[model samples]
Target chain A: MPESTFLDSTELVLNMGPQHPSTHGVLRVILKLDGEKVLGTDCVIGYLHRGVEKIAENRTYAQFNPYVDRMDYVAAISNGLGYCLAIEKLLNVEAPPRAQAVRVILTELNRIASHLVWLGTHALDIGAITPVFYCFREREEALKIFENYCGARLTTHAFRIGGLQYETYDGFEKEVLAFCDMFLPKVDEYEELLTNNRIWAGRLKHVGVLNAEECKEYGVTGPVLRAAGVKWDLRKAQPYSGYQQYDFEIPTCENGDTYDRYTVRIEEMRQSARIMRQAVEKLAAGPIMAKVPKVIKPPVGEVYVSIEAPKGELGYYVVSDGTTQPYRVRVRPPSFVNLQALGRMVAGGLVADVVAIIGTLDIVLGEVDR
Target chain B: MADEQKPAGSPSPAPSGAGGVNPKAGPAAGAPKTAPPKPAAAAPPKPPAIMAATPWDSELARDLRDRFPDQIGETSTYLGQDFLIAKPDAIISILEYLKLEADFDYLVDITAVDWPKKPERFELVYILYSFAHNRRVRVKTSIADGYRPASAVGVHLTANWLEREVYDMFGIEFAGHPDLRRILLPEEWQGFPLRKEYSIVQQDERWVRENLGIESGQ
Candidate 1:
């Protein structure tokens, strides 16, 4: 204590949320700070743990399809698609062409909806509240399509195991295409509001930079990895659910800053819209469901199927021991793995930049703690 | 039985027997509607067993086996996916070999499966994706309970939290984890929920009662 001097660096520990509002959800980050600069961050998660993987073991394959939607509620359709694809692979029967087209349209629409929520809230966290209103208003249109197709908004278990639960509604293609037409112009409106703003650029430009090498090493994925110049998307990489037929580009940025992530996600919304329009055009009338047995007793084996969720790679590794219920269903949730890079991303940044970086990561705590 | 098994394919059986009665009957008793797929006793074996995943040796698997003949066990392909079962002791070498030599740069996920009945009760699964090759491979190794497997954080930084997750959910400890207390559950919480014996509704009731002043919360 006597040797303490002004030149000697001392760190102060700050406890930021198990309930702090700025944090996305119940994420408690123990921040070691040297004045304004952050020394390191320890993310204390699991406040919303529901033991979802354990729940899968107790439920049958068809019974557990809806449970996946709760993990990433914002992108619930994407989760449903991943689970359905995994089960279908386990059963060794592909969904009919019509079902595959509808799945593509719904999942791509969910991608846009998810990115809108992220853009709105992320901008709101950084003091740009105007885009939030515009974002949600446009999001309502997409949610309307979801409601019309599946009678639910957020956690819509839209797809069943082998195929869709219901056939496409009378105007499913028309409605989804209408949403696409109405959605693209609104994306431009939100971009006009924040993309060139002075404070938006200043707060995000050089803040919390993680490069390409570090991104892969830390296993950070989705837009965060793409923003770091890694040209990787699970849709393009693995091509599940007929994504190969859809033509789109993976947007990447040289700088992996918060601003770059914002740009990457914004461009991603455009590409998703492109996919939805194409999927609508590609929608041909055919049988929806495959010849799945009354009891779905898959062989004793395993299959890993991943889809490009709105967040990142949402993978389902389903192990079947020749039973109706899966032996093990381990979800490699993107947000959970993406959240691990928080300490690395927030290290050595300003304490104030912590929220911006967390917002930039775009983590959903339900998926993180599931 | 053959007609019932191939409801759409075998139209010859419907013409041979009761063809006149089937025509006179109403829509409920149609000729093609012989019976549901269940009651026809001589149904063939499920096609999935014939298509079940088997031990496969691809060019890459053969190359890997040549390098680590003693360590590699079964290299199986299931539904177009290839996974290798490796020995627990040589996991790091195999992972490093794949990373450096085979260009499996991205460690996609790390999860563990609990097989309580087996002598090696824990099967650790590592899913690795290679960007250069545009392929993914699963590497699994089984170990006895309470065995402190070497931590993979040194080889792949992504394994830090993923391994901690497996440890938190299954109570398997890694030997060299930097901070492996608990990621999802609290420090005071007990029981690994993902283990097979742990029921779905099970929770750490003592911790809940002490912290929240409630008897139990699940």
Candidate 2:
């Protein structure tokens, strides 16, 4: 007591990840703590770096499409969609209306699937355990739809630069319609489990509150931005791949808190179903692949095309130097940008809230490190 | 079934199969026919009187050139995205102006392209998006090997990790970056992996040998 200085000596340093389950992946957060309260946080990422940008420079444009799936493994189809659309833009080729419609169907299904994983894991992180199983139980159906469309369930390289590599499977439309029918109710069930739960609301209501302006400053996007009451979904903002044709609303929540993010994502899943139904209902009679040259050599230029990926604005910046290989392919991963807000979100929150904040951010470490 | 599983190289099926929707239905009713147009500003950005002689096309670009005529280089458009080339010294100032004046608040991405043969070998790319204007512009600048590009973290906080990533991959330093440490690679790891001259297989071999103590079967 006699030796007490102005600064608190009781502040402790806590390392919260690189292996901890609550971190979502290998995201390590170095937390400066004062008892249970977090004073500062430095997120140490790159534990899962596979040198994707380097890999893109080495591989041919077509060869690199598969690797894009590895970045955001939870939403691999969305990754494929963004990559193909960017390359298509660079190559100055357009996927046909039928192909575009099919692409939207697959991507929206994947978006639902991605949000399901987020809702499940986020609720579990907040201590509501039952929702995880319920989320997965429903998520399995979306994965099955992907499996039917493409052989791979996870990391399905489901799109090509010009169009879809594989045509819609024989029962693909029926299966997607089935998923659309099944998933809408499951979202409600998940909400029922966590939306009003005392533990869930108490843990999340006021925790990790990042206002809309702070979100913009930090470059946070996707559900987190929408949660902050910004109706800035890239799909609606800059409609890519015929997203303009689909009717849907960008779900936004006030308060920018963890609960807000939760509600936003939940609404998004329902909206994704609406988009899928429209796309599948009008599943047209045409080819899935666009006509292009045998060897894909885009002109010497760069193009940045972004999509409203489930997590956020997933943009692919492709620079082609009149070569089969890309001169540079920069992936503007939403999670990577969104993760910048974590320090601001966690600064004044409790140590336990760090997990909820991390979960609320819905970061996939593969995308972060890539 | 075997035909369905065939890979991409084979002759693709014609696009006019029984797969598409009703052509007669047209696009779904009530869907917006077009995306929202670029947000209209009340008055077009006034060209800075300093560089009135310069042939700057866009209002924002002209304003940037007028403010820092020395730093502003050539401006071009690639596939609808605008590119504003800025000298290394002028990047932060130009970015600050864009953030404050032009409303390019969202710093979308920061990356670099390697050109081993060129004298100014590294072309750093900064993509910025403005929610207000609903527009995107790419700011690019080239730096010679070993030249440090000023970090945009001071102008935009999001540039912190992005600059770290560029530094990690290309081995280019950003002056004034708060934490200029390797982000994607181990601290002890040697050599920049994304440069044009760096051999991927060789780097992998060396990294595995040094870090994991195992022979990389390359």
Candidate 3:
């Protein structure tokens, strides 16, 4: 009689999102389930598509600067940094030393802020309610630093093609130092809240296991790649904007599971804080903007520039036809690439673990759809 | 075309003036003496500073030319990065060889450019990165309008979404792509948005009217 009952069970098809809170923005994953075990999954994206690449072609080089801010709104500074670097490379000029140092400081701070948002929302997704508040408390300080520098909080276009558009606020160093002093203890507080919590570990460890090889195949990067035991970080791999000057260890974990990703991000926050401290100490005093032409026109060629964004390797491929407007601008968004591994990570796992897997991926649909 | 004309235009009088100052000035003021025929051959023609050194010592370019001579067209360097122009149909084999033998295990990105005036209209660019060497090279090949380049899914699994995106934005199909649906646009959407002929001011009027219940403002 029990075997007959098992034989009679029909598989259930579940549509998880396009509006679901845990799906992380408008991502819809269709999961084929047989009694809580997932057989197949297809991720449906592009819900927030704004056609950014198409828009890039229409706008002049300078005109398109602000648009990069809307993609990966959490790490707006990183997007701006990557786009600016690509354009600067096309123009065959480098940002002044002071500007590069300031860029490194602001971008690393943005990395921390972006990761804090990820920690908060990802914890919120997995039902750990308290860490979200602690995360915001730290993230608000980082945003305050940006507001002081750029006047905009969420979508801060902090850097220009040649250098920083706005000079540092009077006490930029002091304020950043104050933040670093407060941020380290707050990181400790976050770890205490969720790092070893039995419920947190139960939900995260071994929940979604993706190995290093699978990560490579799917073009996954950032903390996920590090979590899968690959010691690859673009900051270290290809030192850009004076990352080579800072001495900080890249964190990696061997498990390639949800817990490893969590640990990797937490350690990365600590390293980011370390880099910020070193940057502030070595922050030279000089001009912020370089000798850039007023009418920004890059030569006729194509260049791809990538930076170590908080989520992963954020690359901007710019093709110029000796014109003010780019012939083509392609953004290799980390969230979009990492989202490719969702199906691989979720297969054969319980339906309930799907939320944990999605949170582990830490996708911002703004970047995915852009 | 532009590069060849530059040297021809600039270097004509350099050898003549130098020789005129030393030996050939005997005929210089007199018209026929201005031509420094002997020194021109004696100088052996020094290359311009820009072309003095082959910017990137790209071993991959050499290997590609050696292995698949027919597929490799020309390798050019811009800003110290090598761009290998490959034959359109030979993209799959070139990429596979690079991935397997050359240790370019990572597919960083795949994108395309639209040249409206050119006969081979679409420029498909494949950006590949080698972890072992910590180097990046771009493989570029051109295709005409509506021609499908071979899919790179067989070379890199990450190409699945990238090829779909290329197809969605540029309307240049990937011949062997498993799922080549419109990625960023609706399935019922009309035209490729990234083409030079495609203006951003234009939109699918019917879809906009039906889906959002609003006029597209023309």
Candidate 4:
């Protein structure tokens, strides 16, 4: 017997954005919703894809350094570090001690800057505007330090194949020290504003809870996985670029909720500061460049190198065929993988909580779409 | 020193005393020598073999070899790393066995390489990581022109998008990929741009025409 179907009970399909403001960046999230609760969410990326890997196959090894910065513009230096480390591993070259120390300082500063942008915009998305301004004030100082070193701020192509393109400029250390002196106090100010504020707590606490098992199943890392109580930071588990020498803590939270994610990142900014301070103190004198062959031709082989990028484990897999150009280059972008867990996290939550969950994930769409 | 003698941009040949025939330089010329006579006195207790049988356990390699002898072309255990090379058709079966029997749950990455000089135009590489065992294995399969390899998307859901990306760039088809649409490029784009022969000039024209259709000529 055929039963009569009712069309009135059907779920509404909403297009959240190939253009909407809060989808992060040209990301189109196809949402199937029933009333105010989300039934399902399908994330459609690639809108901002520039074919970076394809472009890398044609460009010389030296020429690809700058392009890596565009993959995650918010954390430009970290992306550059990942690509450079992969290339360096293939070539079997090690950067000088001073260069490694400087790289640690710069990348940690970049991590702080990236987290500030995420906190500010993420808070703004949830209707907290004052924190955005405060976040930018601190971020400006970090950008100035970057500009002093590389003559560029936002998309700094500071790294090179073998080592740094140039040594730290005169007065660079003084400027970075000044920023750090002021920056730690600014982190406390941010904590006072949002960390314990009742409204902020109400909005975030227990809103998007994803436990450690679920995090691993979905492959979410960085703050998301740490908040879920997994102590699997690539920096600690598998150190690359001399991360083993640094003394910093990997902060974790047991709740695995939106508030936990926020707290973890806040604590991470402090640890990044601690790491930067150690890097500056231990800074040494040596040649920045490694003694690499001029026309670099690594024997045919493939190497996968990953770093603890601000978002998560940003890995680069490079295939060399004894030539200047790489045979293949694949980037295991953290945002793209981390964003896969969004649907599971947001399925049963209210529409308002979706913004909070997205904030907690802290995804940069350029990294995702790349 | 070898570093001083080598000129810029030239590939340095391996030293003659090094083991194996240097790939760049042909085998060294020398007459064969007879084995030396054994000493009359009892030889000092043979030093324990300096080299372990292979860094990786040979029994595991033998087990894998026995399981897929027909499909596996080679099993290499060097420096505590294992590499298994197989035909394109048998990748899914081998991967499934690894995932089910062994606990290699994570598909770390999937990539492809182009070798213009080889009989096979492309080599599809899959790296799997096992968190349980704290070990990693690399599987490679060579594909000739216009042929497709069986997809591993059935084993790990994450491989669906990754395989699509590999197909999009390398123009190598995955026979059983659920959704094989163009990911980075527009659906109507003419050719796979990452292949060695794909022209950058063609991309320039396409970029201009797509962005500014009528004004491209001007």
Best by lDDT: 1
Q: Scored by CA lDDT, what does every candidate get? A: 0.84, 0.81, 0.83, 0.77
- Scored against the true structure, residue B19 in model 4 reaches a CA lDDT of 36
- lDDT by residue (A275-326, candidate 1, tens digit) is 9999888999987777665456678788888888888888999888765567
Instruction: Encode model 2's per-residue lDDT on A75-128: one tens digit a residue.
Output: 998999899889888767898888899888888888888888998888878787
For each candidate, what TM-score against the reference?
0.91, 0.89, 0.89, 0.83
Better of 1 and 4 by DockQ: 1
Q: After aligning candidate 2 to the native by TM-score, how far in Å is the CA of A33 from where it should be?
A: 1.5
**What are the root-mean-square deviations of the candidates from the true structure over C-alphas?**
7.4, 9.5, 12.1, 10.8
Docking class of 1: acceptable
Candidate 1: pairs in clash: none
User: Which scores better on DockQ, 2 or 4?
Assistant: 2
Better by TM-score, candidate 2 or 1:
1
Q: Which candidate leads the pack in TM-score?
A: 1
What is the C-alpha lDDT profile of model 3 across B47-158, one tens digit per residue?
2323211334567777788998988778778888887888998889988898889888889899988888889989999998888889889998999997878889988999
Off by over 4 Å in 1: A1-9, B1-51
* Candidate 2 chain B lowest-lDDT run of ten: B23-32
